[model samples]
Target chain A: TQLLEQSPQFLSIQEGENLTVYCNSSSVFSSLQWYRQEPGEGPVLLVTVVTGGEVKKLKRLTFQFGDARKDSSLHITAAQTGDTGLYLCAGPNNAGNMLTFGGGTRLMVKP
Target chain B: NAGVTQTPKFRVLKTGQSMTLLCAQDMNHEYMYWYRQDPGMGLRLIHYSVGEGTTAKGEVPDGYNVSRLKKQNFLLGLESAAPSQTSVYFCATGSIRRQPQHFGDGTRLSIL
Candidate 1:
């Protein structure tokens, strides 16, 4: 099984709509990170949450880490067409130098 | 500076053929990783290195091998490619703390 699992594998919403993607894991991580990947490009770091029950906002996107550090969520408000891409969550492994990535959530904002 | 660069953006190989994908990073990171992405699957780690001259197996290391002879460069090699090995390969460099990572575009490989 995948170390991390993401919900709603595919999400399509109209422009200006709001949507949330979730990532869950059974293992605890010191920190969790969110990344967005566009076609023909590599995934880009969006935000990182180091504290349990931490919340971070990046422009129209908000990220939250569960209090247990086993899950995370990314919410985008007033979504735009440019938000169409893949959103992934990752956390460090037991070694702290390697990472285990979530399956991924594909988001599409129609114009 | 180029954050991360991958060579031969795309390639096609016949079954049993061997090839190598190169990844270079300029961020002076101490850790590097290789992952493969397929439809419906998030990226799966194939191999990783904490520093020069050291490598470790990841979740999905089968059919793949890696070498990190130099800190700035990491290489993934396919000893004998199979159709099941067709996927997009990505290389990433981790931050000092390893929370977030910087990734190379990707190398799309096809084995027929």
Candidate 2:
């Protein structure tokens, strides 16, 4: 089974601080996606990185895919309370549609 | 658009009982998935259907079953409930090809 390991399982930061979460794996992926899920709700797609070494920015959030296609990262700048949630990274499984998710990084941003 | 909707926002079942979680999508997407999330374990795929009348097992499909009789609806059933099965379940659907999926508010199932 393809497994994605995410580091910093838990994070707590004050507002305006910066934080980064990493997802690494030994298997190459066709695409990698990052999602943020709030309490009581299903996850929402934050970004999808398909190309190796590609970078995409969504406002204050930035996502990067590894050149080898085996890792990804999510960075949040000037964090806000709204950024508090469970951040997950996933890649398409062998079936192509099913995703194998990382354990997750729970972030709590304090004011 | 209602996106995706899962019936019975919350349910509590006893051991050996059975129940089905209904997931309906109005977006007309062809791919649908069911996932379970534990406190610190992230999300694990239980079952999925790529289209109507098709079903496939995911990474953790033990003690779970799924059916997609229609393009817009996927059903997940538990033949016999166990405490280990208790978790927050989410349903998601996407378009014909690879696309960002839209999700539904999850169902919180508790087995006592």
Task: Give all TM-scores, in the order shown.
Answer: 0.93, 0.95
Q: Per-residue lDDT of A11-102 in model 2, one digit per residue for the tens? A: 99999999999999999999998999988888998889999999999999999999999999999999999999999998987767678889
Best DockQ among the predictions, by candidate number? 1
Residue B20 error, candidate 1, Å: 0.9
Worst 10 residues of 1 chain A by lDDT: A94-103
Give RMSD to native, each candidate. 1.8, 1.5
Runs off by more than 4 Å, candidate 2 = A95-97, B96-100
TM-score attained by model 2: 0.95
For candidate 2, give the lDDT: 0.90
lDDT (tens digit, per residue) of candidate 1 on B1-112? 1589999899999999999999999999988989999987888889888889999988889898899999999999999999999999999897564543788999999999
Model 2 Cα shift for residue A108 (angstroms): 0.7
